[model samples]
Target: MSFRNLAAAFALTCVAVPALAQTPAPATTAHSASDMGLKMADTATVKLKFVTVKPADITSSKLIGTNVYNNNKETVGEIEDLVIENGKTVTGVIVSVGGFLGLGERYVVLDPSTISVSNKDNKWAAYVDTDKDTLNKAPTFDYSKKK
Candidate 1:
Protein backbone atom coordinates (compact mmCIF):
# COMPACT_ATOMS: atom_id res chain seq x y z
CA MET A 1 0.00 0.00 0.00
CA SER A 2 1.09 3.55 -0.66
CA PHE A 3 1.81 6.16 1.98
CA ARG A 4 -1.51 7.90 1.45
CA ASN A 5 -3.40 4.67 1.88
CA LEU A 6 -1.32 3.80 4.93
CA ALA A 7 -2.05 7.18 6.47
CA ALA A 8 -5.72 6.84 5.69
CA ALA A 9 -5.76 3.39 7.21
CA PHE A 10 -4.03 4.67 10.32
CA ALA A 11 -6.38 7.63 10.59
CA LEU A 12 -9.42 5.44 10.18
CA THR A 13 -8.07 3.08 12.80
CA CYS A 14 -7.49 6.00 15.15
CA VAL A 15 -11.08 7.11 14.79
CA ALA A 16 -13.75 5.91 17.20
CA VAL A 17 -15.59 3.71 14.77
CA PRO A 18 -18.45 1.51 15.89
CA ALA A 19 -17.07 -1.22 13.66
CA LEU A 20 -13.89 -1.98 11.79
CA ALA A 21 -13.64 -1.05 8.13
CA GLN A 22 -13.83 -4.04 5.85
CA THR A 23 -10.42 -5.13 4.65
CA PRO A 24 -9.29 -3.26 1.49
CA ALA A 25 -12.67 -1.52 1.80
CA PRO A 26 -14.22 -4.38 -0.16
CA ALA A 27 -12.47 -3.30 -3.33
CA THR A 28 -13.96 0.13 -3.80
CA THR A 29 -15.40 1.10 -7.16
CA ALA A 30 -14.13 4.58 -6.66
CA HIS A 31 -10.78 5.35 -8.19
CA SER A 32 -7.75 3.90 -6.43
CA ALA A 33 -4.72 5.80 -5.25
CA SER A 34 -2.97 5.25 -8.58
CA ASP A 35 -5.98 6.44 -10.53
CA MET A 36 -6.58 9.43 -8.30
CA GLY A 37 -2.97 10.53 -8.66
CA LEU A 38 -2.20 9.51 -12.25
CA LYS A 39 -5.71 9.48 -13.65
CA MET A 40 -4.69 6.12 -15.04
CA ALA A 41 -7.85 4.05 -14.98
CA ASP A 42 -11.07 5.26 -16.49
CA THR A 43 -13.17 2.34 -15.30
CA ALA A 44 -13.68 0.69 -11.94
CA THR A 45 -12.34 -2.73 -11.05
CA VAL A 46 -14.95 -3.33 -8.35
CA LYS A 47 -18.57 -2.54 -7.73
CA LEU A 48 -19.38 -0.40 -4.73
CA LYS A 49 -22.81 0.16 -3.27
CA PHE A 50 -24.05 3.69 -2.70
CA VAL A 51 -27.29 5.56 -2.29
CA THR A 52 -27.75 8.79 -4.14
CA VAL A 53 -29.35 11.46 -2.01
CA LYS A 54 -31.99 13.29 -3.99
CA PRO A 55 -31.93 17.00 -4.67
CA ALA A 56 -34.60 17.56 -2.06
CA ASP A 57 -32.32 16.13 0.59
CA ILE A 58 -29.70 18.80 0.07
CA THR A 59 -29.88 21.63 2.61
CA SER A 60 -29.31 24.12 -0.20
CA SER A 61 -31.91 22.37 -2.33
CA LYS A 62 -34.21 25.31 -3.02
CA LEU A 63 -31.60 27.98 -2.75
CA ILE A 64 -30.82 28.02 -6.53
CA GLY A 65 -27.33 29.12 -5.49
CA THR A 66 -25.45 27.39 -2.69
CA ASN A 67 -21.82 27.42 -1.69
CA VAL A 68 -19.70 24.27 -1.40
CA TYR A 69 -17.39 23.96 1.56
CA ASN A 70 -14.17 22.08 2.19
CA ASN A 71 -13.40 19.54 4.92
CA ASN A 72 -12.17 22.34 7.15
CA LYS A 73 -15.40 24.28 6.63
CA GLU A 74 -13.95 26.81 4.25
CA THR A 75 -15.90 28.02 1.27
CA VAL A 76 -14.40 26.52 -1.87
CA GLY A 77 -16.85 27.58 -4.53
CA GLU A 78 -20.42 27.74 -5.70
CA ILE A 79 -21.76 24.68 -7.47
CA GLU A 80 -22.96 26.14 -10.72
CA ASP A 81 -22.93 22.93 -12.76
CA LEU A 82 -22.20 19.20 -12.53
CA VAL A 83 -20.31 17.10 -15.05
CA ILE A 84 -20.04 13.37 -15.46
CA GLU A 85 -17.40 11.66 -17.48
CA ASN A 86 -17.39 8.54 -19.75
CA GLY A 87 -21.16 8.36 -19.88
CA LYS A 88 -21.29 6.95 -16.36
CA THR A 89 -19.35 7.94 -13.28
CA VAL A 90 -19.47 11.48 -11.97
CA THR A 91 -15.98 12.73 -12.70
CA GLY A 92 -15.93 16.47 -12.36
CA VAL A 93 -18.03 19.08 -10.62
CA ILE A 94 -18.08 22.50 -12.27
CA VAL A 95 -17.81 25.17 -9.61
CA SER A 96 -18.36 28.87 -10.17
CA VAL A 97 -16.57 30.72 -7.47
CA GLY A 98 -14.87 34.02 -6.74
CA GLY A 99 -15.49 37.22 -8.59
CA PHE A 100 -18.32 39.63 -7.87
CA LEU A 101 -21.86 38.78 -8.88
CA GLY A 102 -21.05 36.72 -11.98
CA LEU A 103 -18.65 39.33 -13.27
CA GLY A 104 -15.79 36.80 -13.06
CA GLU A 105 -17.26 33.48 -12.16
CA ARG A 106 -14.46 31.01 -12.77
CA TYR A 107 -15.27 27.52 -13.90
CA VAL A 108 -13.18 25.27 -11.73
CA VAL A 109 -13.37 21.52 -11.79
CA LEU A 110 -13.55 19.71 -8.46
CA ASP A 111 -12.80 16.03 -8.67
CA PRO A 112 -15.88 13.99 -7.84
CA SER A 113 -13.86 11.69 -5.61
CA THR A 114 -12.94 14.66 -3.44
CA ILE A 115 -16.58 15.29 -2.62
CA SER A 116 -18.87 13.54 -0.19
CA VAL A 117 -22.39 13.86 1.08
CA SER A 118 -22.09 16.33 3.93
CA ASN A 119 -24.30 14.89 6.64
CA LYS A 120 -26.10 18.00 7.76
CA ASP A 121 -29.11 18.05 10.01
CA ASN A 122 -31.90 16.27 8.13
CA LYS A 123 -30.28 17.20 4.84
CA TRP A 124 -27.23 16.84 2.61
CA ALA A 125 -24.48 19.21 1.59
CA ALA A 126 -21.69 18.90 -0.99
CA TYR A 127 -18.34 19.21 0.72
CA VAL A 128 -15.12 19.19 -1.25
CA ASP A 129 -11.90 18.14 0.49
CA THR A 130 -9.52 20.79 -0.80
CA ASP A 131 -9.33 24.42 0.25
CA LYS A 132 -10.16 27.44 -1.90
CA ASP A 133 -6.73 28.17 -3.26
CA THR A 134 -6.00 24.52 -3.93
CA LEU A 135 -9.41 24.17 -5.51
CA ASN A 136 -8.72 27.14 -7.74
CA LYS A 137 -5.38 25.73 -8.73
CA ALA A 138 -6.79 22.40 -9.90
CA PRO A 139 -6.54 21.47 -13.56
CA THR A 140 -9.25 22.59 -15.95
CA PHE A 141 -11.19 20.17 -18.10
CA ASP A 142 -12.89 20.37 -21.46
CA TYR A 143 -16.46 19.53 -20.55
CA SER A 144 -17.82 19.25 -24.07
CA LYS A 145 -18.81 15.67 -23.36
CA LYS A 146 -22.12 16.39 -21.67
CA LYS A 147 -23.72 13.37 -20.11
Candidate 2:
Protein backbone atom coordinates (compact mmCIF):
# COMPACT_ATOMS: atom_id res chain seq x y z
CA MET A 1 0.00 0.00 0.00
CA SER A 2 1.12 3.59 -0.51
CA PHE A 3 2.48 5.30 2.62
CA ARG A 4 -0.29 7.96 2.55
CA ASN A 5 -3.01 5.31 2.19
CA LEU A 6 -1.55 3.18 5.00
CA ALA A 7 -1.37 6.19 7.34
CA ALA A 8 -4.97 7.14 6.50
CA ALA A 9 -6.17 3.56 7.24
CA PHE A 10 -4.27 3.47 10.54
CA ALA A 11 -5.79 6.80 11.69
CA LEU A 12 -9.30 5.65 10.82
CA THR A 13 -8.78 2.36 12.66
CA CYS A 14 -7.61 4.08 15.81
CA VAL A 15 -10.65 6.41 15.84
CA ALA A 16 -13.21 3.77 14.90
CA VAL A 17 -11.91 1.07 17.31
CA PRO A 18 -12.75 3.08 20.44
CA ALA A 19 -16.23 4.01 19.12
CA LEU A 20 -17.01 0.36 18.24
CA ALA A 21 -15.78 -1.00 21.59
CA GLN A 22 -18.19 1.17 23.71
CA THR A 23 -21.34 -0.59 24.92
CA PRO A 24 -24.63 1.33 24.82
CA ALA A 25 -26.28 1.98 28.20
CA PRO A 26 -29.34 -0.14 28.91
CA ALA A 27 -32.72 1.55 28.39
CA THR A 28 -34.78 2.06 31.56
CA THR A 29 -38.55 2.02 32.11
CA ALA A 30 -40.83 2.80 35.02
CA HIS A 31 -41.33 -0.26 37.22
CA SER A 32 -44.18 -1.43 39.41
CA ALA A 33 -44.33 -3.96 42.26
CA SER A 34 -45.80 -6.62 39.95
CA ASP A 35 -43.01 -6.05 37.41
CA MET A 36 -40.49 -7.49 39.91
CA GLY A 37 -42.87 -10.29 41.05
CA LEU A 38 -43.63 -8.44 44.29
CA LYS A 39 -47.13 -8.05 45.72
CA MET A 40 -48.44 -4.91 47.45
CA ALA A 41 -49.72 -5.35 50.99
CA ASP A 42 -53.38 -4.73 51.75
CA THR A 43 -54.35 -1.38 53.26
CA ALA A 44 -55.87 -3.20 56.21
CA THR A 45 -52.43 -4.56 57.09
CA VAL A 46 -51.03 -1.03 57.57
CA LYS A 47 -51.49 0.77 60.88
CA LEU A 48 -51.35 4.53 61.35
CA LYS A 49 -50.42 5.91 64.74
CA PHE A 50 -50.44 9.49 66.02
CA VAL A 51 -47.60 10.82 68.13
CA THR A 52 -48.88 12.23 71.42
CA VAL A 53 -47.21 14.96 73.43
CA LYS A 54 -48.03 16.72 76.66
CA PRO A 55 -49.26 20.33 76.60
CA ALA A 56 -46.12 21.37 78.41
CA ASP A 57 -43.87 19.76 75.83
CA ILE A 58 -41.76 22.39 74.08
CA THR A 59 -41.57 22.09 70.31
CA SER A 60 -38.75 23.58 68.29
CA SER A 61 -41.02 26.12 66.64
CA LYS A 62 -42.59 27.02 69.96
CA LEU A 63 -39.17 27.43 71.54
CA ILE A 64 -38.14 29.90 68.89
CA GLY A 65 -39.73 33.39 69.21
CA THR A 66 -40.85 32.53 72.74
CA ASN A 67 -40.14 35.27 75.19
CA VAL A 68 -37.39 34.54 77.70
CA TYR A 69 -37.74 35.95 81.21
CA ASN A 70 -35.34 36.11 84.08
CA ASN A 71 -35.77 34.95 87.66
CA ASN A 72 -36.85 38.49 88.57
CA LYS A 73 -39.83 38.20 86.21
CA GLU A 74 -38.20 40.59 83.82
CA THR A 75 -38.15 40.19 80.04
CA VAL A 76 -34.59 39.55 79.01
CA GLY A 77 -35.11 38.67 75.37
CA GLU A 78 -36.67 36.28 72.95
CA ILE A 79 -35.22 33.06 71.57
CA GLU A 80 -33.74 33.75 68.17
CA ASP A 81 -32.34 30.32 67.37
CA LEU A 82 -31.83 26.84 68.80
CA VAL A 83 -28.62 24.84 68.74
CA ILE A 84 -29.36 21.19 68.08
CA GLU A 85 -26.73 18.52 68.70
CA ASN A 86 -26.49 15.47 66.38
CA GLY A 87 -29.96 16.27 64.95
CA LYS A 88 -31.61 14.70 67.98
CA THR A 89 -31.21 16.86 71.09
CA VAL A 90 -31.16 20.61 71.70
CA THR A 91 -27.97 21.85 73.31
CA GLY A 92 -28.40 25.62 73.57
CA VAL A 93 -30.38 28.65 72.42
CA ILE A 94 -29.45 32.00 70.94
CA VAL A 95 -31.14 34.86 72.78
CA SER A 96 -31.49 38.32 71.27
CA VAL A 97 -31.05 40.87 74.02
CA GLY A 98 -29.97 44.44 74.79
CA GLY A 99 -31.27 46.07 71.65
CA PHE A 100 -34.08 48.34 70.56
CA LEU A 101 -35.82 47.36 67.37
CA GLY A 102 -32.91 45.00 66.56
CA LEU A 103 -30.44 47.83 66.05
CA GLY A 104 -28.03 47.27 68.97
CA GLU A 105 -29.27 43.75 69.68
CA ARG A 106 -26.70 41.08 70.37
CA TYR A 107 -27.14 37.30 70.57
CA VAL A 108 -26.18 35.34 73.66
CA VAL A 109 -25.83 31.57 73.85
CA LEU A 110 -27.37 29.73 76.83
CA ASP A 111 -27.90 26.09 77.56
CA PRO A 112 -31.39 24.77 76.85
CA SER A 113 -31.41 23.05 80.23
CA THR A 114 -31.04 26.41 81.92
CA ILE A 115 -34.42 27.52 80.61
CA SER A 116 -37.78 26.41 81.96
CA VAL A 117 -41.30 26.66 80.58
CA SER A 118 -44.46 27.22 82.59
CA ASN A 119 -48.16 27.78 82.05
CA LYS A 120 -49.18 31.12 83.46
CA ASP A 121 -52.46 32.94 82.77
CA ASN A 122 -53.30 30.59 79.90
CA LYS A 123 -50.00 31.42 78.17
CA TRP A 124 -46.71 29.57 77.89
CA ALA A 125 -43.84 31.39 79.57
CA ALA A 126 -40.13 30.66 79.31
CA TYR A 127 -37.79 31.57 82.12
CA VAL A 128 -34.04 31.66 82.37
CA ASP A 129 -32.33 31.74 85.78
CA THR A 130 -30.17 34.69 84.78
CA ASP A 131 -31.28 38.29 84.77
CA LYS A 132 -31.22 40.73 81.87
CA ASP A 133 -28.22 42.56 83.26
CA THR A 134 -26.19 39.43 83.31
CA LEU A 135 -27.31 38.35 79.87
CA ASN A 136 -26.49 41.74 78.40
CA LYS A 137 -22.97 41.45 79.80
CA ALA A 138 -22.52 37.87 78.55
CA PRO A 139 -20.40 37.17 75.49
CA THR A 140 -22.24 37.87 72.26
CA PHE A 141 -22.88 35.03 69.84
CA ASP A 142 -22.33 35.80 66.17
CA TYR A 143 -23.96 33.52 63.63
CA SER A 144 -21.69 34.79 60.85
CA LYS A 145 -18.65 33.45 62.70
CA LYS A 146 -18.85 29.71 62.27
CA LYS A 147 -16.34 27.03 63.27
Kindly list the per-residue Cα lDDT of model 2 for residues 1-147, writing each as its tens digit: 443333333332222332333232236744333322112455433233223344434455555567888888888998766664432334567789988887798999898678887767857678988877799899988863242
Candidate 2 steric clashes? 0
Model 1 CA deviation exceeding 4 Å by range: 1-65, 141-147
The CA root-mean-square deviation of candidate 1, after full C-alpha superposition on the true structure, stands at: 11.8
Best model number under TM-score: 2
Residue 84 in model 1: lDDT: 32
**Tens-digit lDDT track for model 1 on 1-147?**
444333332332322123433435335555443332112357864454333333433322321145788888877677655443432344556677666777755777767567665555744456776777776666654433232
- Residue 72 in model 1: lDDT: 87
lDDT of each: 0.50, 0.61
Residue 122 CA displacement from its true place in model 2, Å:
3.4
The C-alpha TM-scores of every prediction are 0.46, 0.59
